[model samples]
Target: MAAEQAPSSNDVRTWERIDFHAHLLPDFYQRALTETGEAGPDGMSAAPGWNVQDALSMMDRTGIRFAVLSLSSPGVHFGDDAAARRLARRINEFGAALVTEQPDRFAMLATLPLPDVDGAVAELEYALDVLHLDGVAIETNARGLYPGDDAMRPVFEALEARSALLFLHPTSPPNHGSVSFGRPRPILEFPLETTRAVIDLVLAGTLRRSPRVRVLVPHGGGALAVLADRVATLAPAQMDLGDVDVIAELGALYYDVAGMPVPRQLPALLQLASKDRLLYGSDWPFTPIPIIEAMAAAIGSTDLLTDADREHIGWRNAVTLLPRLAALAH
Candidate 1:
């Protein structure tokens, strides 16, 4: 691996204006590709298409002062527990090293071999205690098991104990649904799956029990934002205890502006969520990084929020969620 360069004087354009979600492939994954000389699992984008330099350049151009990197979808689901554990360690270490090399520009969200509850718990400890990562990133469903499932209680317990930040990225569940039968992943399914996992966590008592636990839901919080009212009306028994309006409960959680660039969606989200709870995300490598600048500008242009609201959404909110960054501004 190459040494990371220090951020230039110009690089410090705006402290704390960071992107909370993006991804990278570790060296082990590259080795696996090199040794096997084969394309990875189908319907997955885990290939070595992007790297750290690309990420940094994007940040520089977009006026983003920092970024928190995490592993993308299908995380550790492709291998057995041992393989998954080893891969997660390598990825987490690489992420930590990247942050260390460029302390001014990066932070990390640790990856875990989830559903293997023991391994996930152990990985969380190692990543936080050893690597000093800011948070953990887990997919919507780990091998067909939702975060609400009892099997993942250990991971949740460990995270809740530490008030850890969890970045929830959506992945298609096993045999998700028919999407033209041949279409790849079906764009609709990603948001739908995210909605499913979000509801599962709320209804299964995960959110209520872990009040301190902060979760960053991707793709504009998926269908959960759109269907909050509908889910609220399902039944008192259908949801986790407390207010019937799941949408109101969601306001208690957090969201990133990863995919909600459309006019209607952003306003609806603002109406439902407090300004301080919204954060910025680029979904880089998938969406063009330059698009992030456009999104940021669009967000700035919205009358639904005040200048303070835009500033919070653009950066201050992330700083609040990631308390570790409190000292950097000086």
Candidate 2:
């Protein structure tokens, strides 16, 4: 039997196709033909509407050069410490191997066992030192503990020490009383939860303490724009340690225009963040890739960013923080 023939590379320019946010689940998690009674209307766990090969084919058609893979929500964050730890290892190994097999077409954001400091640290070491993942993708909350909870300090510290990129994706809190009025999460819950998480992190001083850890928030930073002023007004002038504006410190974070129309939101984001801190990410699998491309195109057409700035947000910032991707970006 002859060896399998590899697909030929296309002529699309590298810069034309950098999708920062894409998700893929392991085959073990596929619920398409799942016998478990957990299948939702859409299909699988979170997004049953799409799959791995479907995403890659879409990328090819759209001229998307690469996609940074992350596990969809509730990612090892809800399980007990032991289960979470094992799941993190499984996801990272699966993701790293995918990148290894298709070096030029894929990269990864490792998942970690949150709210479990020791497990988080262990997973980070394994992911960075051994598997060589690009970064870690953490949901806004772990069970009921937000990323900024005191228990999560060590996780942030480790990520900061490693200069890791922590992509913050939103997930609904475990308890919901009034919000879930026969609606799917993405319509409103996702953004609402992100706002809550952002506020918690800012008030908790996570941003100030972890200066080296660069975070990228999704869904146009979900309620961040509208709530910035309110947070500043209510924040105390001084913490026991120092005086800092909670809102101002938010500028230190990076945000992606995933699933948002760039023309409508990029200008607002520019007012709140440095051009270099803004990135292009497509919440693929959940949303269509074409919409993401349109957002990027709209942003590119705005003339709001210079060539260097575009390059930085579109590719370089990710590469700088994700040392594993340094050569790939070049």
lDDT of each: 0.76, 0.73
- Give a tens-digit lDDT track for model 2, residues 1-330: 999876433222235446677888666645422433324421224444665688788787766667888877756644468867877898899889888888878889888887777988899889988998988888888777788899888888888888888888887666643666656766778888887898788888898888888788887778787778777776674444257676677788888777664566666667777866666677777776556556666656566667677677777776655555676665
**Which structure among the candidates has the greatest TM-score?**
1
Backbone N/Cα/C clashes per model: 0, 1
Candidate 1's C-alpha runs over 4 A off are 1-16, 30-48, 237-245
C-alpha RMSD (angstroms) for model 1: 5.9
Show the colliding residue pairs in model 1: none
Model 1: which ten-residue window has the lowest total lDDT?
7-16
Q: State the lDDT of candidate 1 residue by residue for 242-318, as single tens digits.
A: 66456666888888888755577776676667878888887776667556666766666667767677678767787
Look at candidate 1 and tell me the lDDT of residue 262: 57
